[model samples]
Target: MSRLLSKLSGGQPVASAPVSVDAHSLDPQRSAEMLAGFEAADIGWFWESDAAGRLTYLTDSAIAAIGAERDALIGSELTQFLATGDSDDLDSTSRPLKFRLASRSPISRLNVTVQTSQSKEIWWEISATPRRDANGEFAGFHGTARDITKSLAQSRDSERAAQFDSLTGLANRLRMARKLDQTLTAFKKSKRSCAIMLLDLDRFKKVNDTLGHPAGDELLKQVATRIKKLLGDHGEIGRLGGDEFQILLPDMDDRGDLGDLSKRLVQMLSQPYSVEGSRAIIGCSIGIAVAPYDGIESSELVKAADLALYAAKDAGRGTYRFYSSELSQNADWRQRIEDDLRDALTQQQFLIQYQPIVDAKTHKIASLEALLRWEHPERGRVSPADFIPVAEELGIINKIGEWVLEEVCTQLSKCPPEVRAAVNVSPIQFASEDFYDTVDAILNKTGVDPARVELEITESVFVGDLERTLKLFKKLKKRGVRLSLDDFGTGYSSLSYLRDAPFDKIKIDQSFVRGCSADDNNNSALVSAIVSMARALKMETVAEGIETKDELAMVKGHGATHLQGYLFSGPISIDELLDRFDSKELEFKPRGPEKYRAERRTEFRKIGVIHGDSRYNVFLRNLSKTGARIEGLLDVPVGTDLVLDLGDGQLAVATVRRSEGFSQGVEFETKLISDGDRGLCTRHRVSPYQIEAAGRPLGALTNSAVAAYTTGSQSVPRAFVEVDMNAYNRR
Candidate 1:
C-alpha cells in the first residue's frame, strides 16, 4: 500500500518497501498483484482536503459515473456541486434533525438528494460516523452512502397506503390519531379546547344480516365517503372499528361545539346510503367528550365518549349524548336496576294503584285510572317516570301493562255498581296481537262493563304508524270499551284522532295545567286555545295535575270539564276510597271541587235506532225515556250511520252509538239533520214531558216520532223497549 500510494501521488515513500521482505528476497511483483486485487473490488475511495470538502481520490468507476477525473473533483468543493438555491446549512442541519438518539421520539426517516462534482444529483442513504486518528481527536466523518432512490420511491408508496383508508381514501385511524395528538397538543398550547366524538351505527347488524356482508361493506365505504366530504378538513374522521367511527374537532371549545357537531353528524348520517343500486339508511348516535373538559387524556376522553354512547343507546338509538359524570353514574345505576327489574318481574313485586275518575256532574267515582307502582323492597318507591321506560326497553312493559289491565278489571268488578276503571296501555302493548284477546278475557272473566272500562294511551303511540294504530283503536272501540288519549298535547302536535277513531276523551298533559297556574309562565290564552282545539274536535278534556285553587279555577275557566291531580287525590287505597265514597266525605278535595258538579249540564237525550238486515230506521228517543232497549238482526258496526226511511223516503242520519252483537243503539246527528228536522228535534228536546198513562207497559213507549216507511209492514217490536239490553247484560 505504501509503494502504491507513493507511485500514485508521485511522492517519496516513507518506508523502504519493507526491508525485511527485501533482505529475504521479497517480490515487488507479488505486492503489485495483491494491490491490484484490492483495487479490483472497485469499492469507492476518497480523500478529503482540510481547506475544502473536495474528493482527492476518485476510483475509476466513481470518476466514470460522475463524468469527472480525480483532479477535477480535488480542486472543486462538494458544496460547489450542490443544486442552486439549495441551502448547505439546511442540508447539513436536516441530516441530524432526522433522528434523535432516543427511540421514544417520533422517527423522522427521510430520503434526500445531493449533487456530485459533475453537477448531477443523486439520492443516498447517508449514515455517517466520525473517522478518528490515533489520538482520538476531531476528524472528518466517513459514511456508508448507498444509492437508495428506488427503495425510497417504494417506501413513499407504502407510506401513502398506510396513512389512508383504502375504501374511503381518507386518513386511516393510525394517521387520524397521530394528527389528533398533534392538534390537541397545539390547541392546549394556545389555551383552547376541542371535542372527540364516537359514532356508532344503530341496527347495523340488521343491515349485514339482511343485506349480506358485501352490501354491508359497500354501505360502510359509501358512508365513509359521505362523512369525509361532509366534514372536510374542519375535523379528522376515521373508522375506528366495525360500524364505529371517531371524529376529532380541534377548533371546538364548549358543549355547544359538541352539540353542533353531534347534530351535524347525525344529520349527515341520517340520509340513505346507496350501494349497488340499493339504498339503506344508516343512523348514527354520537357520544361526545370534549378535551380539557370531559378529560385531558386520550384514553379517558374515549371512555367518557363510550359512556355517553351507551346513554344514547339506552335512551333509544339514533340520538346523541354529551359526556357527563351523571351519565356514568346513571349507566351504573341502570345496569343494577335492569337486573333488579328482571328479578322483580319474576317475583311479582309490582302493584297497581287505582286513581278514581269522578264524574264532574255526578261527584261520584265514575271510573278508576289504574297506575302502576313499583314496590321496590329496598328502594321504597320509584316513579313510573324512572322505571316504566326501563321496563319498556327491557321488553317487560307488555307483562306489566297486562297485569295492570287485568288487575284493574278484577278490582272494578268488586267495586260499587257505577264505578268504572281505566288502565294506561304502553305503545308496546298496543302493538301486541294478543292485546285485544287479553283485554276481552279480563272484561269477561271479571264481568265488568266494557262500556265502563277505558284504556288510555299516550299520543306518541298514535304518531307512529297512524293507519296501523287506527285499526287497533277501532278494534278496541268495537268491543264496547272506551278509549282515551293520555297526555294529549305534550307530544306529537295534536292530531285529529277523535274524528278518525272513537276516542271518548282527551287528557291534557300536566305541563299545560301546571303552566296555567300563577307561578307558571304559560299564558292563560294558550290554555284557552288548547281547550278550544279540544272542543272543536268534539272530545272531552280532562286536565291532569291541577294543584292550587288558582290552577283549578284556571282549568275550569278554560273549559276543562274533568280534573285530576294531587289536588283531587294522591291515589288513595281502594278501601280508603270506598270509605270516603260510602260516607260521602271529601278528605282530599279541592276548594272549588264542589263547583264542578253544579256547573255540568244535564240536558241528556236518549238516541234510538230501528233497523232490519237490509233497510234501517233511526229515531231520537226522548231524554225522559229511561226504558230504552234495542233488538234485531242488524249487523251495523258501532260508528256506521243508520238512515231511517220515513214515508217520503227521506234520509234522517243517525250514528250507531253502541252495539250488542246483532242489535245496535244509535244517536241522532243533530247538527247533521235538515233545517226542518233540526227545528222539530230542537222543539221536542225542550218540550216538558211526562210518561203517558196508557194501557201499555209502564216503561214501554213507541217513541219513534215519525213513522218509517218499509216495503213490507213489519211491526217494530215495542215489547222489547223495557228489557234494557245494557241492564240485562249486567245481570
Candidate 2:
C-alpha cells in the first residue's frame, strides 16, 4: 500500500511545501501574466535553453519580430528561426552553448538579417544576454529582436535622394560634378581619355513663354527620360538647370564614341513630345570637351565644354562642336569685345553717317538713312554685325539705340528741310520700357516733325513678344512717323510679319540688290517678287546696295519706289554734305491739289517782279478797292495760302480758282500778307541777302538770318554753330 501511494504521488507530481509568506509571492500564472505585461509594453522578452539550444520562452514582440507563433518558437531551436549557421554547437552536458553570443550588458545591439517562419526576410538589431540561475551559473540566454527593415529602407532612400534631382528623379548637377571628378581621376590613373558634353536646348525660352511654365516642366521631364533612355547605362546625365544638361563619358576612347553619342542624343531629343496634348519638338546643341586633351581638371573640362556649347549656339544652333584652343581664344575675344561695347555705349564713341535715299521718279535725294558708325579709339571702325549682336545680348542696345535716335534727330533739325532721315533700331531697343515715351522726348528736344523721322527694324524684331510688339506698333503708328523693315529677306523673314506688322517701307536686303543686275532666274525672280509684294501691300520698297546704273535700272524695272546705295551717294559726313548742296531753294511746298490756287496767286504777284520763263507767265487783271484780281496761266488750287507782295508797302493773301495748272483768273486769299518794299526776288532766283534784307520768306527756314548764315552767304556769328566753318566763311 505504501509503494502504491508513493508511485501515485510521484505520478501526480509532488506538491512543494507551501512556503508562501508574503502576499506578493507570485504564482506561475502570475509570473506568466507579468511576462505578458512586458510583451504588451513593446519590450521583447525571450529565453533560450542550454540543453537544446532552443528558445523556451518568447514574448509577443519577440514572436512578432521572429514572425512565428509562440507555440512554434517555444521548444524549437533558435537557429531555425535565425539566419543559417547562427546556432552554437551543443553537447549532452547542460552547459551554455559555445557561440558568438552577444554580452548581456543591459540593452545591446547586433546587426543581422533574420528570416521568419513564413520565409519573410527582414533586417534586425538584436540585443541578447546570458540568463543565470540563483548561483550565477550560465543557464541559458534571453534577447530582444528589433525589426530594422524600415530604418534600412529609409537610409537607402536617403542615399538615393542625395544623388538624384528632386524635380525629375534624374541625376543632378552635384552628382554630375562628383561623377566627372571620379572619371577624371580614373582617366589619370588608367591613361585613358573621356569626354564631357554640355547640352543646351534650342529656343527653349520660347517654349517656356508660349506654353507656360507647367508645360515647360513637363517637357523637361520628358526630355530627361528620353536622354536617360538614350544613355542607357553607357554614360551619366545630369540636369544643370533651365534646359541645360551635362553628360559624362567615363571611358570613351575613340572620338567617334562622342560623335555617335551626341548624334543619338540630338536625334532622341528632336523627337516630338506631347505636353498637355501639344506636340513639340526640342533639339539640343551639344558641346564636347575631351579629357586629357581639351582639359585635365573637371572644372576646366566643364568650362571648355560650355565654350563649345556657346560655339554650337553661335554656329546657328541644333549642332555639335568640339572644344579647341582656337575656340577658347575666340570666346575670350568675344567676351572682351562685349565688355568694350558696353563701355563704348557709355563713352560716346559711336557716331552716325547719313546715306542718301534717292527718289525713283525725280532722282533727287529726298531722305537720308542714318547709319551707325562705331568710331572706336583703338579699333577704328567695327562692323555693325560684330558689335550690334553683342550690344543686343548685353541689353545695352536700348541705351545705344536711344542715343542714336536723339543724335540723329538733332542732326536732322540742322539739315536741309527737304531731307528726311531714318534711324535703325534693334529688337531689344524696340522692346524697351517706355519706348514711345523715349521717342517723344527725343522729338521734343530736337524739334523734328514726326513725318520727317522714320524708324527701321530688322526682320528679327518682329519675332519676339507678339503682344508687346503689336501694342508698340499701334502706339507708334498713331504718332504719324514711318516704320520700315530693314534687311527684309534675312532672318525669320516670314510673310506673316510683313502682313501683320505695321511697316511703311521694305528695304530689300543688300544681297538681293547686289544681284539685281544679274539675269539669273532665281535672282531676278526674288527681287521681282519682293517688289510686287510690296506694291500689292501698299508698302514702298527701297532697293539697297545699288552700286551701278544697271543695278539702279534693274531695281526700277522691278518696281522699287525708292533706292539707297552708292549709285546715289555713299554715306557722307555733315561737312561733305554741306559741300554737295548747290544754290537751291528748299521749300516746304504742300503737294495737295487744294493748295494750288494760293500758289498761283503768289506766282501772279511775283510775275514781273520775278521773271524767269514765259512758261511761268502771270497777269494781274483788275486792281480792286480792297483786293486785286490776279489772272495767271498758272493752275493753282483754290485753298492755297499765298503770301503776295503788292507794290508800295502793301501785301495780300489769295486763293485761286485755276489752281490745277497754268490757266486764267484766281481770287485773293486775304488782305494780310508780308509787305513793305518786299517784292518777290527772281532773275537771280532768290539771294540770301535780299531775302534777309527784306525779311521775306526764307521758305523751309523759319529764321532768315540763321538760314543765310547756314547757307554760307551771311557772315553772321552764332555761339551754337561749329566755330571752324564760321571762321572760314568770315574770311
Scored by TM-score, the top model is 1
Best by lDDT: 2
lDDT of 2 by residue, 242-293 (tens): 8898888876634445666777777678655678765455567888776665
The superposed Cα distance between candidate 2 and the true structure at residue 625, in angstroms, equals: 86
Error of 1 at 87 (Å): 24
Residue 611 of model 2, lDDT score: 19
Q: How well is each residue in 624-726 modelled by candidate 1, as lDDT tens digits?
A: 1111123542455677655433221123456667777555565555422111101111211100011212122221112332232222245544322323444
- For model 2, what is the alpha-carbon lDDT of residue 263? 70
Q: TM-score of each candidate?
A: 0.49, 0.47
Candidate 2 TM-score to native: 0.47
On the 0 to 100 scale, the lDDT of residue 721 in model 2 is: 15
Worst 10 residues of 1 by lDDT: 674-683
Quote the RMSD, in angstroms, for model 1.
29.6
Candidate 1, lDDT over the whole model: 0.58
